[model samples]
Target chain A: MSDLSRLSLNQATIKYAGMEQAVSACLRAEIPGIGLWREPVAEYGLRKTGALLRQAGLTPTSMCRGGFFTSPDSDQRIKDLADNRAAVDECAELGVPELVLVSGGLPDGSRDVDGARSMVLDSLAELAPYAGERGVRLAIEPLHPMFCSDRCVVATLGQALDLASRFPAEQVGVVVDTYHIWWDPTVYQAIERAEGRISAFQVCDWITPLPAGVLLGRGMMGDGCIELRRMREAVDKAGYTGPIEVEIFNQEIWDADAMEIAELTAARYVEHVL
Target chain B: MSDLSRLSLNQATIKYAGMEQAVSACLRAEIPGIGLWREPVAEYGLRKTGALLRQAGLTPTSMCRGGFFTSPDSDQRIKDLADNRAAVDECAELGVPELVLVSGGLPDGSRDVDGARSMVLDSLAELAPYAGERGVRLAIEPLHPMFCSDRCVVATLGQALDLASRFPAEQVGVVVDTYHIWWDPTVYQAIERAEGRISAFQVCDWITPLPAGVLLGRGMMGDGCIELRRMREAVDKAGYTGPIEVEIFNQEIWDADAMEIAELTAARYVEHVL
Candidate 1:
């Protein structure tokens, strides 16, 4: 049986919940770890939030998002780098070892995805060392291909690993989210290949007839067609003993009470994933 | 300049038009060919439709679609095969050499994509010889990965090519549709690898803020962000000299007058695709 002790809640799942409430909910529900978003950390004051989680005996599993180096404008690129550097500092301040990076999409009026990808690699070359110095690994999260043109150029776990492979496994890794990589034919092989560099394993079921904007369609566990158990098994077999973060983005779920949602997520994780 | 002589109007782009009107409109516009859908041809009397198009000197580029064998139920699978066989017969009667196949999604209550994919291959094995004997090639059109669960298990051009490679190039081939494949990072390499096996080249741009159903979100050419010209150039370089069929599925376009839509599609084809 898969381990339930490592279950983590990404703050986005309960979109309306503040960091204090989310961390408290996780602690109350015995969800050992929680993934932090930069906005929430900023809102709560990073140092205070870190102390709150630590005081409550909660682990900060991973940090959400620090990568948007695809801008064609040099000034924008410089600003993005500064923001990313600040994100790295935030990771260190929060005592989280992994910083999740969602590489930005293509530049304005540019259809050059290759150029965007090259910028990601180039930025990583500059930032990985900085992150490594601060003892925080950067985890590249590959968003689904549906978001390729606007949200993320890295649309597959294999592509994430390809980029991550350029840096040391200690400094860079990949995030395997079932919602994003479930449709990939070679995902199992990619998971096996990801072995050591699998920094975070995120779970979110995929339901179709996607709503407008496509961002809020991530269904809760056991709610969609994704093989949650199968994906969990693959990640487990890949030798990843890290926390499995539940990171859903559905609107209706977010409208519910935070504690109720946390309990439901835990039950679903046990039944459908663990 | 790209050859407009090879341009074909996929009937879906002008969904409001009857087969007779579509054929007449193509002829009026000096368009060389048309890709047809089964429902209209069946409604118009297949043989009569074929005769009408032939008399109008319009080539029958391809027939739209015949593959939905992902049902877990044996009876449904049998029915799907029967329907596909009937579609192949219709292809012969319509004088269309290519029959597009959108392999259906996961079976009910099942999340096994691998199992669904195997069913596709098995169904293809049964249908390929039947199609080949009828002088038709089954063109596996991989829908975007977003549709993998509910529409098609064949979700990548590479996966389509892999399946097609198992059969003779004359009997089985791949359809390269820009709307479905524009997000694929390895698409250009897949196009290069699809040399001599590309049965059809379909064009449609992809616009963001996908609609509620995400089905009718295909943009008119040049309105969205796809590198349509690059994809056209890739297909041409890959030795696919077949008709370039415009196949958009936007509801707004469908509500417009058929002749106006056809003219706009042709103009867009010349400006954005060719």
Candidate 2:
């Protein structure tokens, strides 16, 4: 069996699981960390969820997300920034150091990607310090280009780092997700460049024949063609000694039994990623 | 009416139409150029297809594709190389100057992307000379990262150029497809770097909620969020004054009447791309 010491469950991997079941599974499997999402945490009551995790001695690795900073509408931008700030507060409350930020896609009906990216930076300017003061690092997650139009405008790890460079390293950093960035030609160098700014190292394999909307296409570690172990080594070499979170968003895996999913993920983490 | 001077109808846009219908639509619209795919041209008799385009006073802009050069099997690699040579011969036969190369995905069940990319360069080294001798430039088309797994491994214009840079510019160049490269953060600079090495400029807008396969997700020019005119200008500024090929691969467009698709593409080309 692989070492589960650094393995963190992103919770999205077994997407339908309740907090109670997720923590129970982690505790049973000796998985030391669990990354929580905002919606489910709110549903379970944040204080109670924190109590359960603290009681179980499970480290809350990172929060789900807190960035949609690309809308053209002024009101929408204000609301998104506020939501991001609230997300940072939540991360601080949970004792999670990193809050994942999915920079939103282009403004509706706008074709200016560069402009949208600029807006991402502008929003970061406003939110980074606030997050830093809360002891929460804003981790910019670069979703694959397939989601560039609908989900995150940050399409490359390099771009994410470029955005993060403007703010303090502790306040702003990049997420090195294998699923989103495995296809990048400059990935190794970008990972090396990430160095101290690497906030969270998320793992998921990229399987082909992406589903409609192309949202839930992530694979279990060994099921796809990603060089998971190689990337893990690279991220580790770049000074990232944090929890390695498995964050597959595939539908079939989500539909499977939660405990089974966690078990298989742990096994695969040992076989393919470790 | 939009200037049909440089507009080229890539036959795949009206995917079901025969050679005669495609040529007729282009002729009727006064579109001066056409891009042909190998399958349909082979079906129609290569010489006869050439004669038909010549008779219709149409220019054959580019040969659809010729690069699946990423198999570990020696026999498969030999067959693929021979096929690429045949594609070059077809391009020369139809008097087309450029043959689009879609550097294939990873070897079956392989996670070595770097190794797959190296294989692409090795194949290009063999094919470029043969293509150049026949007066055809191998146009390295960097397909979108979404296709990096199944369809094409060259996932960025910069990567394509890096591969192309090793060969003589006349023998090896790159294709700038709006649908593929528009999401790239450094795209504009990459276009400028392409300079005289740009062999073809293909236009197709990117739309979201991509279909299951993600292959037919290309949108007609103005129907999506891509800034086509800006890219068109950049390509022109990069010294590419060649045929502007409209190559939409949407199944819905393919199902529509051929003539209507051509007309709408022409209108959109004028409005959004010209």
Candidate 3:
């Protein structure tokens, strides 16, 4: 069997599950790691959630997010920075070393993508030091280009690596989520270039006929045409010995039982992504 | 008034119009050129369509497409090649110098994108010589990465240029469509590198919350956030003094009056893309 110890169930994959339930599901499936999200940790109370994971012997793989620093509103921008710092503090409390950063999209009524990108970099310069001081690495996640307008402007692995390379590798890293970067022709080369900067290696499949909002269309492992095992192997070759988190966001997957989803995900990971 | 002499109205912008009607509409709107599609040319009878275009003093800017060589079935591959050759023949008959090529997506149940990409190259090697002999330049159009799986595997201008460089620039070139490539970080640089091999320059806008199938979601020139003028300037700076074809694919656009649509497109081309 593939190493179950290295498998992580990102809470988003089982969207309906509470933080407590997600930890229990991971425990029941013998999944040694659980990737936490900021909202759920806050909902369950950070200390209680951290204690729950500790009690279950489950490692907190990484925190879900902490970026969105491209708001056009000055007040919102300040709020976003403050929120990100809080995320870093949460990571410290949860003992999670990595915090995924989703750089926000272009500002409302604005076509200046370069400006938005610069804002992300500027925010990172401020936050990276804070995150590093708390032993939390900021993992810049290059979301799919389709999400460039409203979700995240960092659209390619190369761009993410270029930004991450600007900071110390430990302070600023990248999340290689296959759903977003699999379409990139230079992805393998980018992976090779991202040696020590790879903070989290997330896997999900890419099935098309993308649904309306295009947000909840990710396929389950082996349910789509992504060469999952190949991507995992590339990250491994890049010297990343980190947890491989399954992070699907489909509505159908969310409606299912959390433990069943976790068990099936583990099985699929072994079958198709080992 | 911005230059109208170099404008071409691709029939897709007025999707409901028949070939003859599209030609007449372009002529009425004083649109000097048009980009033809194979199906409509075949429907109107290729020779008749060619005669009609010549009679109306309308130039055939480029042929719509001729690729899709990534099918897994051997018979389908043979058929695709044969169809592409016929498209080349049609281009020759119509006196169109360029044929836009959209390389097919992955074969069903296949996860090897590299293998699929190689198939496109091999097919190009075979077809390039045939197209060259007929004086028809094969313009490889790298679609948006969202279409990388189901529609076309060539998903970036750089990748298209890489493939185009392998063949004689006269025989193989690349299409710079703003809607498909605007998200790319290196698009302007790629356009400059395209220099002598830019066969066609197409424009459309990029609006979000893409409709089902995402095929007909392309916005009319000024309806979305793309820096249309900037992209056009980049193409011009790259030394391409050719027809600027407006190729939008949207349901509402298709349902509008073709002549009105053509007139508005011309106006928008001047206001936004010129």
Candidate 4:
């Protein structure tokens, strides 16, 4: 039998369920880990969510996300920095290992992507030290390029690593999610370069002939063509022994029974990834 | 009046029109440049199409495409390389400055994007010498990440440049199409780094609240929220003085009259960009 202990279920995999229900479902399935999002945590209250997960004997894998550093105005940027500091505080309070970050996209009313990226770096520099002191490692999640306009400025593993390399490894690192970066040519090299600084490793399949322009077309394991074993091998080779988080966002799966989705994800992790 | 001399029309913008019809429309409108595709040229016969464009004073800006380097087997890769060499010959014969390359996506039954990229690089190395001998520059077009699985492997401008930097500038360059790369955070810096290697600059708008699952949701010039003038300025600052090709692939624009679309594109370029 394969070891299924390394599997983690990101809450987004069954986001339709309330935070309490999700925690119960994870407990029911005996899934080893959970990745929490801010919205649900805020709704249920952080202390309650933390207590629920702890009661379920689940390790919090990583926080859902916390970066959007690009803005057209200086005041807006300062406000975003403040917001990120708050996210860091939340992650620390939740006792999560890392605070996942989706770097902000281009500033509104502007097309200078490079300029916006510099602003992201500046914001990260400001937030990393605060997050470091709080014992919450900043895990930069490089989203797919499709989200580069309105979602995240960090769009590749290499770019994320480049940004992370600027800070101390203990303060800033990267999250390797198969759904966001499986198509990137430099992903393997970037992962290798990331070494032990890979704070999180995520898995989800990419559905072919992508469903229109919806940015969130995440497929469940074995439903799409991602070679999970190979990606896991890459992470292992890079010395990352963190829990493998299942972070799917498929609408069909989300609409299904949350317990069923959580159970299926755990089974898929055992059957496909392990 | 703003100079219309710099405007070029990509055939895909009017995909509904026949090659002869597209050429006739360009001639009627007095547009100076035309980007041709192999399918239409093959359909109408190359000799006749070449003669028609030549007689109409249409300078072929760049060939439609010539790279699909990733495949599941060596035989398929060999076939792709041979086809690309033939495309290089066609571009040379047509006297175009560059042969646009959409480095093909993942090979079937393969999830190793790095391996697929190696295949692409190997194929380019095999084809570049031949392309260089024929005086045709291979322009690597960094398609949107949505196309990364089924369409093209090169998904970001930085990734494309990193690959291109492996070869001589004359042998490998890039096609900066706004539709494919407007969302990249490092797009401007990547373009600036590309500098003398920016062979072609293409334009298209991005529509938000995109339709479901169809990843190729291209917007027309003024229909979406892309900062066209800013993109133009970026390309200009990169020192590319080539034709500013309007290369929209929107269903709405394609369903319109070809002549009307061309006229509208020209008008938009003048009003928004000039």
Candidate 5:
């Protein structure tokens, strides 16, 4: 059996709940790790949120996101870089292991995805050293292809590993989220390539006959069709002995009681995924 | 400028309209080509639909779909192969140049995408002779990765082309559709690789920040943010001189009058895409 204590709850799983409540619920459930987003951190004020997490004796696995590198203008790209630098600073303050980077989509009024990816690489290279100096690791999260146009340009595990390979291992890496990469044929091989550089391992399930819009149907663990045990085996083979973070973005789960959701997520991890 | 007479109206654009009405509207609009779906053809009676298209002087560009080879049982796989053979016969009877094939997603209760893909390739190899004998070319259409779990397993243009390269060009080829593949960084290179083997070329825009619960939000030529001109340039440079078929699956267009939608689609193709 896997270690249930390594389970981390991403706050977006219960985004309908306030940040303090989510932190408190994680403590109540004895979930050792938590992943946070900028909005909630800002809403609660970082210092207070950090103190509360410290009080709850929870370690932050990662800071939710940073990096929308593709933009129509150099000025916008520079602005994004500056914003990411600030995100890096925030990660350093939070003492998180990694800052999840979601490479932004096609630039406005631009149709060249290759060009947008080039911009992303250049921005990552520029941001890496600053982040490295601050002891903050950058974790590129390859979102599912559904978000290719508007959310993130990096859309597969192989693609993320390819990008990460371009930079030093300590400067850049990848987050293997089952929600985003469970469908990739090259996922296992990509995981093997990311062995030592595997920054985060996120878990979620994919539901069938996805409703008209593909974004809102992310299923919670055990609720959908993904074989969590198989994925865990792949991660284990890849030598990634890290926190198995549950980062579900389900509409139904978000509206339920925060504490209840956390406890149920913990129990589900123990019964199904672990 | 693109050849306006080479424009093909995929019937799914105005899905709410009956097959006969869509064909009549396209003929009236002086559109030279039409792509048919099996459901509408079966509903309207294939003979009636075929006779109407002939009577109206509209050329069938290609069949809308034919492959969903992944299944839980050997019986279903065999059945899928037989169904594909039938679809090939339909395409040949309709004088269509190619039958579009969408590799099916993961098998029922299975998450092995590689296994599903291997099943698709094996099914294709089995069906290729039947299709070739009927004078029907199989055009593999790679769907967006979002469909990898439920709809189609072929998720990238390069992946589709790579699969096609495994067989004889006369038996297997690729359908390069902008909406499904525009996000790929290697799309331009893939199109170049597909030079003489591109059986079909499709056009549709990719809209951003799509509404919730909608997976098939295909934008019209100028509606969404895809770089249609650049994509057309790549297709042209790659030595493809085929008709650019407009295949939008937008609810907004489907809800409109068939004739009006046809007219607007033609105008948009000329104004923005051509």
Candidate 6:
């Protein structure tokens, strides 16, 4: 069995729950770590939520997101950078070490994925130092390639590492989400390559018959084909001793009671991801 | 602009059409080639279909498809291999040089993606010589990573090439479908690496909000975001001057009039994919 101390409940897994409920769910499940989303933190007042988590003895594992820098418009690019900077500030305030980023997709009517990827590098270059100075790592998360067109241009851990290679390990890192990277053939090698630069080790399952939009199709642990334990071991072997955040986004998962889902996630994590 | 002489209508784009309708639509659109599917060819008698294509002066660009070699059961693997051999024979009989192979996904209840991938190599080792002797190249088509679980495990041009590298070039090669590979960060490098071993160059567009059961979610050319022209040029530069087959699988396209889709595909070929 795995240690419950390392499992973090990412708030998006029970997206229906607000700060207090999410905290309660995590507490009930005995999941020692909790990943916060900027929206919930903002809604609950960042300082208040941070205070509550600290009082409850919960480690804020990471922050949900802070990157969508693929817009071609200079104004949009400026705004996106500012938003990332704000996210960095939020992570720092919440005592979250990792600020996970989902790099934005191609510009409207644009087919230049290469160009979009370069924009991510530029975004990273600008944000990494700021994040590092604030004791936060800008964690680039590569979403599944299915989301490459409309969601994230970073489609592989190798690509994420490539982007992070330019920055110090303290400044920039990559999010290793099993749901996204499990399908990659070079995944193990990439995981090994990401040793020092792994910011967040997120867990989720990948199931088929992906729903429309494909964003909320992540399966719960043991509910899909991914060898979750194998991936967990790979990440662990790669020298990441941080929290393993359960970050599922399925509609079915979200529709369930938050406490029930969190407890179930904890149980499944032990069964499938240990 | 691309040469009309090199354009091939892969029948799946207008999947509603039977062999006769596909041929008629190809004729109406002045397309010089057609990619045949095994199901339709079996429905229309192999010899008769081959004779009809020859009479219509249309080249059989490729045959779709032949490879589900990921089954773990020894008996099932044997069955799959026998079926693939039969597919190669069908392709040979139909005068199609490229037998497009979608190496099957993880076996039911199997999470061994690495083991499943090795099975592909073993399958290739068994099938390549047989295909080479029969004047057919087993063209491994690495599907988009989205299909990596249940449709095709070979999910990148690089992986396909790795499987093909062991076999003689005359026996094994790969299909470079723009829709499947366009999102890859190393796509251009992989394409260049696949120079002499590129057996098929299929074209299609990729749009967002992927329909449930994404098998039929491919977009019509010029309808979605794919750098079709650039990919085509890359293939040409890589020394592949073979028939550029337009293979789309979309419910919307399937529901459309076959001849209209054919004509539109031709127009889109000129405007978007040339």
Model 5 regions lying over 4 Å from their true place = A73-78, A208-214, B43-48, B211-215
C-alpha TM-score for every candidate? 0.98, 0.99, 0.98, 0.87, 0.92, 0.98
Deviating ranges (above 4 Å) for candidate 4: A71-86, A165-168, B73-82, B129-135, B158-173, B184-198, B212-215, B221-241, B271-274
DockQ of each: 0.73, 0.85, 0.71, 0.49, 0.46, 0.83
lDDT tens readout by residue for model 4, B53-162: 88888888988889888887778778888899899999888888799998987777667677777888888889888888899999999898888877788888988898
For model 6, residues A125-182, the per-residue Cα lDDT tens digits are 9988899999999999999999999989999999999999999999999999999989
How many clashes in each structure?
0, 0, 0, 5, 6, 0
TM-score of chain B, candidate 3? 0.98
Docking outcome class, model 3: medium
Q: What is candidate 5's lDDT per residue for B1-274, written digit by digit as tens? A: 3457878999888888898789878977778899888788889877787898898888888897899988869887788888888888888877888899988877667767778888888988998878888888899999887777778888888888888888888789899898888766567888899987788888888886554445557888987767788888888888888777889887788888999989888888887778
Top-down DockQ ranking: 2, 6, 1, 3, 4, 5
- As for candidate 2, its interface RMSD to one decimal place is 0.8
Predicted candidate 3 versus true structure: per-residue lDDT over B1-274, tens digit per residue: 5679999999878878998889878987889999888888888998999889989999999998899989988898899999999999999988999999999998888898999999999999999999999999999999988899987999999999999999999899999999899888888889999999999999998898888778888998888878889999999999999999999999998989999999998889889987
Q: lDDT of each structure?
A: 0.91, 0.91, 0.92, 0.84, 0.83, 0.92
Best prediction by TM-score:
2
What is candidate 1's lDDT per residue for A27-75, written digit by digit as tens?
7778999999999889889889988988998999999989987998989
Q: What is the Cα-based lDDT of residue B196 in candidate 5?
A: 77
Per-residue CA lDDT of candidate 2, range A1-274, in tens?
Answer: 5579999988988779999999987877778899889999999999999999999999999998899899898998899899999999999888999999999998888888989999999999999999999999999999999889888899999999999999889999999999899999999999999999998999989887888988888889999999999999999999999999999888899899999888887888999888
**TM-score, prediction 3:** 0.98
Query: How many Å off is the CA of A187 in candidate 5?
Result: 2.2
Which residue runs does candidate 1 get wrong by more than 4 Å? Answer: A1-3
Per-residue lDDT for A1-274 in model 5, tens only? 4456788999989898888788888888878999999888988898988898887889889888998998878787788899999999888888887999999987666667777788888988999989988988899999887788777889888888888888888889899898888766567778778887888988888886565446667887887667787888788888888888888876778888999989888988887678
Model 3 deviation from native, Cα RMSD in Å: 1.1
Model 2 chain A poorest ten-residue lDDT run: A23-32
What is candidate 4's CA lDDT for residue B236?
A: 91
Q: Candidate 1 — what's its lDDT?
A: 0.91
What is candidate 5's DockQ? 0.46
Please state the error at residue A142 of candidate 1 in Å: 0.7
